[model samples]
Target: MLKQKSGPSRRKVILIGLDSAPPELLLERFLDKMPTIRRLVKNGISGRMRSCDPPITVPAWMVMMTGMDPGQLGIYGFRNRKGWSYSDYYLTTSTMIKEKPIWEIIAQTAGMKSCLIGVPPSYPVRPIMGNLISCFLTPGLEKEYTYPHELRDEVAEIVGEYEFDAAFRSDNRDEILEAIRRMTNKRFDLANYMIEQKEWSFFMLVEIGLDRLHHTFWKYFDDTHPRFESGNRFEMVLEDYYILLDKRIGELIENCGEDTIIIIASDHGSKAMKGAFCINEWLIREGYLKLAERPEGIVSIEDASVDWDKTKAWGWGGYYSRIFFNVKGREDKGILTKEPGGDLDELVTELKEKITRLVDNRGVPMKNTVFSPDELYKTVRGDPPDLMVYLDDLNWRAAGTIGHGKIYLEENDTGPDDSVHSMDGVFILYDPRERIRKDIGTMSIMDAAPTILRRIGLSIPKEMIGKPV
Candidate 1:
């Protein structure tokens, strides 16, 4: 059983997540542009919320909702290894989560209804107390993406083909901007309709457009960005988008009743991409990773040309690096073991030392650090990486591309990405009827779930590590 708090009327709690929203961007850069968010910060509780380790979208939101670390949730990154296998990898989904999220707990344990709209990792929609609309990763607009199944058709009829996200990769900027506007408008409209029509105690939605804009055009906004140009046409693109977002946010707040509490947060923050640290290329040079043959062109790790027998350690790179050891008895073609002075310990130490000392072309040390899973996570479960690393204070992202012939890559190996996920996201709590604390300095994203429960006069689960704010 869970510890409960006595209350009278059940009020609604609305949580809005702006993906990759940072305090640097929200509080400092665009403060003047977004009046609603600015007012929320000035009158309510605001803080710099630390995101999960690796701090990418997939596991971060799960950590925020479940109050569980990535290891405990059995999810380490967007692409997780399928059990103990060395080569197999799969994208994470809501179904893969081992623990119950806050919405489900509210619905089942407290008998309070919840409507989760556009929350990531919620593909293959499950039955909830009220309604649910799965987020960005949904395969297509044609698929059944909403709960009650028929809800999809209804939303289509009303919003005219719901947009999961903008076409950020396209060359035409106008098309991307138009798509973003259309998507944002439709999502806001749908959320408003649900709020008006649905009977629920908890409502939550996450906007991913901020993340898409940062990834595609961060250079245009940040003057210090390496690719930034003076007086570019897209200079005000991100700021303009935030203003538009603020308008929608104002609308949401205006519609909420006096009993409602609005909590705005982000999964992770964003920053300009300095460069890509090619992990596989570095491993090849250090003799930790072996290839069947020296290739003439760039290749991905999935190319099946790697010699697993001779490999001691290898890593895949994203905003962070996930290092894996071919330990005997743990992998299919295992070679390394945990014995004293063996490849596992010695190589890990050596890699850590070498990576920490890395510097950029401007003679600035990366200021990077490496960690063992045991040192960071409270409980080590699932198929977790052997080591995790951050580069240049997360200014530089990791690239797993091999055969690049250099330790550094000027461009992202995956695609045309200008930014990477930062470790610090933003969190703000506002309630007009109540005298909310203004000095809530700093908190982890994990604290949010328990905080939401506390605000709505519900019990906090024993499994949750977060305490009430």
Candidate 2:
């Protein structure tokens, strides 16, 4: 195991995850839209971040936190079991997490403290050696925030107690954008609290705008449909939001202490899902899947509460490109009856071949590929997917009601927020001493964990399939 790098250079690291920022979007709009990111791209070593299989947000965040693969963390998509809609659980404190995360390892070795703020599914704060502000998955732990309790007056002054809600908006775009601005204001205030009142070794903060914007407004941002009839109606408004977010990044830079080692990242890239490609739908066609019942008619899983033990597989996982395969015994008392045998090696091969057969609306075969449950399994102690699938740049990204899944027109069915696997990767430094590997290739979601641990001088047990970035 590489001991924490012996030097003053690796002090006080701050990782800021831009939930769904993508390279293509940045390239197209950074100079014109986001000056903060443009500054970072020019000054800091940052670029495209690769994502994990199915590339769902929960797993991606988990990967960044653990430096392990989905196989080990067993956080493939959100829920171990489903209720309805196959959209993985919106991870929170209650979600199952199985792995020795970076926070634990850092406390063990670095003697440095950490402050986690608004990170996805990072609930309960775990009583680590640092302070925390829960977000994404964790709700109701608002009391533990840096200032909410310690500096209540200041936190209240900057941002009201409008809790962090990922689906902060309704169908109204203006409402959505305003909500984001408020959230951003709150984030800035929280970061200010850390800089002024706290002394910590490591820190992390998350901005959900990227993910939320992409899911609801990607159609407004892009002109050409890489596949579908997308391109938001209120394109200018969405662009303004991007610019505003960029300014936030710039402000964060200005607000932070000069010595803080700043890092910006996205869990995965984002792209337009031509149409919802119901994975279960394809599975049924392929003979590998069997849905207990047709979801009645088309319904947005989000609005329709699914019977965990009934829904088989769901396609839209989250912004990190994940798909959940609901097997019989593996899930929360799994609902799917057509279960796979434990032979992952053989299963993976079969899955890959079948997934390869899928084509885009233009009738072109999707590339990248799929990993078998065996190939993807990390043996992490928890409820994990029996099999997981992957899609490349040309195909992976998906959303709903705009995405590849069955669209629901009902008010509850197609809400303002949807799902996607963003294309942008987190900006990471393999070793400050070692010039970054220019061609380290796109960073996978699973790679982030091991890499962080390795950076801090810890060992990722061999059982993990992912390694240091």
Candidate 3:
């Protein structure tokens, strides 16, 4: 285990997580506008941190904080399958996270306290050594959103009716922009208050507004987007928001004092969504999945009348595709054999070959990538999909809806979304006392937990796959 040099005083670490922040945006394009972040980069180590495979928000953030892979955590995305039941799925929550996060480990080993806010899967708030505020996943203010129960009242007293997230998918751009600003302002105000009032050895807060903004306004800002309009009304929206975020970050830095080590990170990056790949439609075309009758309009796979007895495989879609096989003795309407040399293996191989060679709407061969659960992680757990697929290097989202009559969609099936998640996110580690001015290049998302533990003078746990950077 790597260790930090022993200092005279106890070290405190503060992490500001900007969801869906990309190196292309934060570290390059808007770096000049973000003075505070730029200053940190000049003084410390900053780089493109490679996010995990199938990088969705929930599992990515959790993976960074726990030094574990999605496989080890048994969390694939925001929603996961409950078991072999075809339509039974569960949204990921704090109750599902079994691994000890960095804050929990510090609280257990060093008796250190942490102040956490808006960490994903942090809903249904559990008791911790210090203060806690739930993430966007929280149902509403009616539910207990803070740890210690009473912290909720204090939070309400400060930022009345705290905004967990914005309705970014709405068609009204102006309303969404205002809502995002309000949510961000309230979150940062609460964060500054916690910095002043809470006793914490570790502090972390994830601002989800950035992610929302990216998904909503990406097409307006990015000229490379297929739908980009040169003089769009919201063209400068992202720049203004980044500047506002920088100002908020400056405030947090001012409140945390010089002794604190500040780290800015993101779970995953954002990029212009090329389009949506109708995964289920493609499956139907390939004869892997069969429906009782084709729907007249677009509908979710779950709602569609599927011919399960004839279906060999089906898929769920989001940033990536989760394909499940109807294997014998596993699924309710099992068809394929599970044996190594059986029909299941043969089908999987065939699907892999065909899916990877699939072409886009323009008849151009797509750069599709596929992975099996067993091959992707150290230990596969939970009701994992038979295959995890990244469509066209993640530029195209996997659309689960069917009855579109075509495979490619210009817009999201669920809602309006301009951007998709990418593999490279930004990471900046700044220690005011030590102006190292070193560029560490690319680091793994899992390295964050061990690195934080090492900096705080704690032994790295054996289970952590990443070494301290």
Candidate 4:
């Protein structure tokens, strides 16, 4: 255990998380457009922040807050395996986070107050040292979205209803953009109000509009995009949204006191998506997955016609792929055992080799990277997949839905999502109180928790894997 100092700490810290913000897009491409970030970079440190393996939102953010890997935290992605079944999955929530977040540690050890807003996995809001507002996982505003139940109505009245996230996948581009603007404006307004009215040592806020615009309009902006169109009407949509976000960030920076340490970071970055690689399609072709009968139309992997008894392995898809085996005694209807050569270990090795050799329609190898639990994780817990994979460095996503004719799907099953999560996020740390180091070559998302704790003069527990950067 790490001990805390007795006296009151004068230093304050403010952290702003820009969801899915890439350094290439912001720091290089649109740096001139973002005056606030440019100013921060002039005096502070900026670098490429390396995201976790399979850099999806849920695990990435949790890793940043807890300084723990997904294996240790028992969270892999937005959806996790519910049981020993082949297909069942449950959405991750605040309850799923077993590790104590940095905010709780700060409050417990140093008796410091923290105001956290729109941080994911913070739904079903609990009592924090200061105020709390739940993240995108919140079911609805009608339900309790605030720490103090009464704060919900007060926030709504002051900021005109909290916006969890925008429906960017909808076909109505105009309506989607309008909703995004409204949501972003209200979020900043609420954040400004909270900073002014509330008393706190650490304040953190996460904005999701950037993630929404990247998903909805990256194709319109990127010339190398597979589905790119020249001179498209929405080509400037993503860039314009960033400009708007930068202005609000500037306002927030101006409002903060000089003693405060400001850190702007992202869970992961975004890149133009190539397409979806159907993981289930590959499993079916390889005879690992068994279907009851030949189907003419598209069907979910969980279809009743599927035979679970004969199935040896299956995959769940998202920004990355999670492969599971029906090991005997582990799964209820498992057929294979860990006996001799023909067992769970052998099956995993065979599948990994076969999947990495997969080629696209043009005969170019997919060059997928795969990781087993023992290979990637420090401490394993819960129902982790037998194999975790990233296809084409996450430029191409994975999909489990069968009946897509071939292995590749041109569009997302959800709708028109143009971007996929990337490993290179942005990190900018500015502290006016002290002269910090000039440049940090690369930083990990896991470095955030310990670093923040140190900034606010709190102890970093021995259990945390990350050291202050």
What is the lDDT for 171 in model 1? Answer: 63
Worst 10 residues of 2 by lDDT: 403-412
Q: Write the per-residue lDDT of candidate 4 for residues 1-469, one digit (tens) a residue.
A: 8544225564788889999999888788998999888878777888888888658788888889999888898888888888786567888888878898888887888777888899988887878888999998888988789987777776988798789989888788888888888999999999998888877888899998889988888889899999999999998988888899899988887788777888899999999999999888888888988888756787777762567789898887789998888778888878888887777778878888987887876788887899997788799887788899899888788887888768888888767899999998988889886645467878888888998888777778888888888
What TM-scores do the predictions have?
0.95, 0.74, 0.98, 0.96
Which of 2 and 3 is ahead in lDDT?
3
- Candidate number that wins on TM-score, 1 or 2: 1
Off by over 4 Å in 1: 1-7, 435-437
Q: Which stretches of candidate 3 lie over 4 Å from their true place?
A: 1-9
- lDDT measured at residue 82 in model 3 versus the true structure, 0 to 100: 81
Identify the leading candidate in terms of lDDT: 3
Q: Which stretches of candidate 4 lie over 4 Å from their true place?
A: 1-9, 435-437
Of 2 and 4, which scores higher on lDDT? Answer: 4
Candidates 2 and 3, the one with greater TM-score: 3
lDDT of 2 by residue, 213-237 (tens): 7766665656653422454356675
Residues 1-469, model 1: lDDT tens digits: 8534224655678888899999898877888988888888887888888998879898899899998888778788889877767668989887888798888888777788888888978987878878999989898977779988888877887798888888775467767777787888899998888888877788898998888888888888898888888798988889889999999988987877776888889998899999899988888888888999977788788773889989888888898998888888887788888889987788888889999998885778898989998888888887788899999889888988788888887778887788988888989988777645584767898899898888777788888877777
Colliding pairs, model 4: none
